[model samples]
Every structure is written in structure tokens, then in C-alpha cells.
Target: MRIRNSVIVITGAASGVGRATALHFARHRVSLVLASRRVEALEALVAECQALGSRAIAVPTDTSEYDDVRQLASRAVQEYGRIDIWVNNAAVSFFSPFLAVPMADFRRVIDVNVMGYVHGARVALERMQDQGAGVVVNVASIVGAVPQPYTSAYSVSKAAVRALGVSLGSELGLDRQKHIHVCTVLPPTIDTPFFQHAANYTGRRAVAMPPVYSPERVAKAILRLAERPRHELVVGRLGRSMVRQHRLMPGRMEKVMAHQVENTHLSKKQAADPSSGNLYAPSLDPATAQVTGGWKGRRRSARRTLAGAALLGVGVVVLADRLRTART
Candidate 1:
């Protein structure tokens, strides 16, 4: 669809991929509805979009609340007269072993990551059904397909998000609502403030795993989805490879991921005390809310990771052969 003069609603527009996506749509001269709990951040982003020659509004929304999400949709329609595209991008992460994670924290993660998307999709669909067409873009992570240790809740929630899109799309097809499209995006570890805002109970600093890509990449994928909806779009090379490898060799991939999470996803440096982050409430100070995570993640190449894993397997077989020969 032509983005110029299109109406787009983006949740979690305060920072990270949502912020970048909002700016990207703004550049296309779309009418934008920006939602997040941080009113200050949302206001600033609205101004930025306006400066780019787009009509934009700031809606302080808590996605976990169904009412708030409904109001967001209502407000957008009230101002723009219709909803064209809805991007369900608000989410929270929890870092801890599944058994060690608090029940409340796990539930909160589900509330935001999974149910939040559900609410947005429902509201958008209602308006779209009335209008006879619309697109819904869901931002799920690679973890949705390949689970990561110490963040079981987050992984499960993202997986549910992906399933939500697929199931919803099928239901729409059954009704012959072909004009309504559901697209899911699976992004790699991104350079965002996600780590800083995550609920951490691991007693270690959290960081995006290697091969982190800029949020702009994911934002670009979202824009493409708006134009032409696809079933699922994987954002980065590393994320795509990981998904393929896990499907091919689940057992070996599990070992590799376990090592990667324990070593690369956490920092050995002393970490600050654990907190609930924004899971229960907004934790980002409005004054400091920004897009980048300021995390200079490890500079490991995606090719190197694949090559190293292959070399390790070869070396293991050769060493076993040498040991057997020596024993003989």
C-alpha cells in the first residue's frame, strides 16, 4: 500500500524499534498515533514526527490494559477518521532461570509481551473490519522460534505472539477478509534499551547477544510489511541462521545456545541490584528515555559463529580418532 498519507498506529513508540519504526513511517508522510506509558517521551517523538511533515499524536497507553489499548484505537480514529496500519511492538523482557523467576514477574511478562499484542490486534481488527481493510504488524523476536535459557518467560511470550498472528490470519482468511493482513517480524538481538529496562534476577548485567543489529533494520522490515504483508520475516542473518539450525539440529543447537547465553548474554562484571523494571510499571525515566541501548555488544561475526561451530565439531571427531589410535 502507498505509505504516503497512510494512517499508522505504533505502540511502544517511546524507544527502541518502535521509535525507529515511527520515524520511518513519519518520513513517508503518514498520520501517526504513537502510544507508550511515557507521556514525555511520546510527546517528544510526536514533535519529531511533526517536524518530518506528518500529522502525529501522543497517546499515553499501557498496553497491558485492555481499556487503554481500546482508548488508543478510539483516539486514533477520532483524530484520523480511520486506522490503516497497526504495529504491536510494546514488550518487556525478564532475565532469570524459569524456576527462579517469580510468579508475578512471569505473569507480567505474559501480560505485556503476549496479551498486549492481542489487545492491540483486536482493537485494530475491529476498526479495520469496519473500514474493510488494514494491516497488523507484530514484532516478535527470534527467541520466539529458538528458546533462550534464563529468559524462558520472554521466549514463551514471543512464541505465543508469533502464533497469534498465524492463527488470526487463518481466521481472517476463513472469513474471506483477504484485505486484512497479519505480518510477524522476527528480529535478532537489537541495539535497544531493552536490556536496561528488563527485569533482571540473574545477578549479572544483561546485554544483547552477539551479532546485534541496529533498530533501523527492524524498522525497515516493518515498513516493508506495511507495503506487502508476509507470513513471517526474519530480520538479521544471524537470527535467520539460528532459526534454521535449531529446526535442523535441536539438540546440538540447544547446547550452543546454552553456552552462548551463559557466556555472552550476561556480563561477569558486578551488576546492580535486580528490579522488576517496567514489567509492573514504567521504569524508564522520561528525561533519559532514548532509542539506543548504549551497549557496545560483542563484535562477533555471524559467519564466524557458524564457521567456529563447524570447526569445533570437526576437531572433536579428529581428537576422538587420535585417542582411539593411541589406545590401540
Candidate 2:
């Protein structure tokens, strides 16, 4: 469990939460196998980790391919003589109505988000079974626990992750082959290029959610979990509240969410590629703190969203009869 000199394999290490966690583990002197399709970024991350005095390798892995995942495990074992921990962190997102989202995007999302994690868990379990101990960590989202509008595919993929974690954890508990453990970490929106990199079915991207937690906060939690494995951990009070509210009142929650989406919708605007797609340049390292100026800007935008939604919902309710009559 000690990260110091422990061997760990992480997927999607090119950016975002994966990048942050890789650096955090490196700082703790953990040996690392960092994987992603972005060879440039992965190499940079590997160099960073090595500079911190940890043995590391950068593997260009496409998690959607089962063979690629298998090779990832084999390469790590070949280099380190064993695998200790495997983290499934690669994922993609789409924002739009389910009916409008393209089939290609849907399939790709499933291939990367759901099946990728499944592959990691499967390979990690096999190696752990051989060694008599190991750990597997999955990075799901708050969406795994609570569904939201404009992210049907994204929500479904995360929900699948939640289901897999619980079921696999139960199996690992009883398998008797080793002390292998499965742990899931769910974090709210973080200040990452993820939103910028995500695809949009509606042809536009909404401004990211405010109060986004820094990736370092999530990384710190992962470090803690490594020391003491929990079945699951949810990050941040905001994420926990949303999950609780949805459970407490589904209908009211639906209405509130519907109003918010309608009022703050950016579906009409032209979409731009997310910066995280920029696999070049010095990547955004694990930030220790959130930028205050950026935080305030996002807060103001969020307030306008709330106030506008309340007004729009009231207007729609009052004008319902007139609008229906006109339709006839």
C-alpha cells in the first residue's frame, strides 16, 4: 500500500486526473507505467516522473483494444517483474440529447469508458492472482451516481463503471487467489482540459461547471485510498449533495434540472475543440490550488444561469395555455 517504491500502472496518463495522479505517485517514489494514445504527452509525464527519482515507462496504449491493454500489463510485468497496482482512468464525454447523439460517438464512448476499465481490471486481476496481492483503481464520475441532462452517453458509461466496481469488488473479496482489491473514485468537475476535449452532440459546448475541484485534491484522495483501500470514495461536498438531492426527490430534481438546462443551454453556438486535445506543449501540471480570478468568473456565469432558469421556468408555466391554444 505504500506508494514509496511501489509499482503502479495508470491509463490516460497524458492529461487531467491521470496526469495529476501519476505525478503525485512519482513524488512518493512509486515506480510507474503511464499509458495513453498521446505518446508525446505520455513521454513528458514519464520524464517528469523519472526526474523525481522513480523508475517509469510511457506506453502508448489504446484502451479500446483488448490486445493493447494486455500488452500494457505484460510490458509492466516484463520491466518490473510484477504488477502491484492498476488504475483505469481513460475516458471520454459527449453532451447532447440521446436521440441526437451520433452512433459512432456513442460506440466510441462505450469502447473507451466502459470496456477500457473492464480490460484493466481483468488484466490486473490476472497478474495479482499470480502474485498473491494487488490493487485496481477506477476513475468514474459523479455521473456514475446521478444522471444529468445533455450527457446521456457520458452518464450511461459512468453508471456502467459504478456497476462494474461493486460487482468486481464483491468477486475480489471472495476469489481466494490473492488480496486483490477494487476501488472506485468519483470526483466532481475538475479544472481540466476534459470539458474542452469532450465532444458535443449539440454542436456547442457549455461553459464548464464552476467550483471545479483541482485535480490535486482528487490525487490526494487517491493517495489516501492506496494506503487504505475502500470499496468506493466520492470527492467533494458538492458532488455528495447532488447525489443526495437526486435520491431525495427525483421529480423535483428533474424539473429543476430541466429548467437549468433550458435557460443555460449553449446548443446553438458553434463548438470548438477542447484544449486537452492539444497533446503538445507543456501540459498543465498538477495544480496545487484553483485560480481565484477564474473561480469568480465561473461563479458569476453560474449565478446568471440560476436566475435565468427560474425566470424562464415561470414564464413557460404562465404562458402554457396561450402557447397550447396557438398550436391548435
Candidate 3:
């Protein structure tokens, strides 16, 4: 399945990996139905893609809402006549200790991460089945592949996405219309606003994760997945290896991730400041093609390129934690 000129629906398209993927497909002349909560941001992306000669529309959407997602699917089909691919990338994270983690935060994370994917899956499945061919991509996290400390709810949600992908993949294989493919993408902490934006109980600066990847790399992997139609893709090599290591050496891996949870810290946290955490999704500062690898779109975060910078910036090298996280 070629990517060029195909109609694609991408959730979380306002920024991060989804934004990069949207621009990537646009570069290839794909028609796009992009959805996100940020209407201005989505509109900006659509404008950029249109400048690149792709027909793209921005739809302000809350994936957690079933009707909104169904509407998104319907809009894509109505505008483009068919839905070739659907990417579910919207998500939230919780960083307090499991017992202390707020129930509201936990529920919100589940609703957006797990339930959002469910909505996308349900909508895309119907359209794809009717069209006789289509694809769905679930953007999960490597944290869910194996349990880590402080992010218990986030881990649980991601694991559910992985499980859902496995289930959907099997179901599609056995379905009468075998062209409906289900794919999941699991990546480690990428250089995005996720750290600063992640919900935390600790009052301080953003706690860091291990080495992170560029959203562009993950976007490229997703584009490849769209073409090849794989069941699951782990973006970062180290993240993938860590998941395998955890499976074989649970005790050791647990200790490692435990230390990570303990060591991460935040820059500035104010319990009194009532700004909603959702206001700060991981964002990118899109630069010239020279620095960000040809993605000169609006507000895109560049992955660390220098070996030392990459090691230092990503959550991989940092263990300093000023915040709290939920445990298993």
C-alpha cells in the first residue's frame, strides 16, 4: 500500500509525532483529515500541508468523545470518499505514586489513552470494513511493554493499547475483509513537551526520563508501518531492548526503573498555581530544515542529535526526580 495520495486521518495532529507524521504524509501528497484539541495549531498544520500541495483539513476534536471520533471518521469519508488510514495518537500521563495518584488523573489518562484508541478503532473499523481496505495505528508507549515505577496508570493504559492492538490484529486477520490492519507504535520518551506537561503530584520542575528519540524518527517509523502494515513497532532501539530485558530479568529491570523513578526531578513546581496540566502538551519549536531534518513546520521539537546532548537531554541519562509518580 503506497502512502502517496491516500486519505489519512490522524489524531493528536497538533504537535509531536502526530504532527511530524502529518507533515511527512503531506510531503508525499497524501490527503489528510487531522484532528486535535488545538484548533489553531491544527489549522496551522493544515496550512503548511496545503502549501506543500496536499489537500488537508483540520478538525478540532476530543478523541475521548465517541461522537467526536465517529464524526471525524465520517468527515474523512465524506470529504475524501474513503478512509485509507487512521492514527490514534492522543494521550495523557500520570506521574504520582500509584497509591497517591489522583483517581481523576488516572481516569483521565485511561479515557484519553485507552478509550480514545477504542473510539478510533471502532470508527475506523466500520469505515474500513465498508471500504474493503484500511489501516489503524495506535500510538502507545514503551513504558507499557513492561512495568516501571511512578507512572503506574500511564503504564497500564499503554499496556491496554498493546493488548488492544494484539486483539484487533487477530480479529482483522480472521475477518472477511482482511485489509483492515491494526498497528501499534511504542516508543520511549521522545524530545517533546511531554515531560513539562505530564501530570505530577510533586511541586517542582519536570522530572526527566531516559534517552529520548526525535518525533521525526517515530513519524518515519509510522509512515513505514502504514506502507508495510506491521502489527507492532517499537521505535527506539534501547527502549525495545529494555522491554526485552525486563521480560527476561524482571527483578533487575524493576530495580533499574525503580532507581529512575526515584532519581527524576522537576524544574519549578507550584501547588498553588492552578494551571491545568493539559495546557502544556509536549511542543516542538520548528526550526529551519537544516537543524530539524527538513521539518520546518510550526513548533516542532527536534530530537537530540549530538551523542552527548542526546544522552544528557533524554530521560534515559537523567535519574533526578523532583516530582512523585504512581507505582504498581
TM-score of each: 0.91, 0.81, 0.82
Per-residue C-alpha lDDT of model 3 across residues 1-328, encoded as one tens digit per residue: 7898899999988777788888888999989999988777788889998999899998888988899998998899899999999999988776666787678778888888999999999999898888888889999988877677767778899999999999998888777556779999998766555554567765544544545567787888889889998989988666676676677556666666666556643334334232236723433333311112222222222322332243333333323331232221
Q: After best superposition, candidate 3 residue 277: deviation in angstroms? A: 0.5
**Candidates 1 and 3, the one with greater TM-score:** 1
lDDT (C-alpha, whole model) for all candidates = 0.87, 0.75, 0.75
Segments in model 3 whose C-alpha atoms lie over 4 Å from true places: 265-276, 279-328
Tens-place lDDT digits, model 2, residues 221-317: 7877777888889887656655665676556555665655544544446564432221222224433111121333333446545544554454455
Off by over 4 Å in 2: 176-178, 257-328
TM-score of 3: 0.82
Clashes of 3: 37
Error of 1 at 173 (Å): 1.3
**Top lDDT prediction, candidate number:** 1
Report the lDDT tens digits of candidate 1 across residue range 38-86.
8889999999999999999999999999999999999999999999999
lDDT of 1 at 135: 96
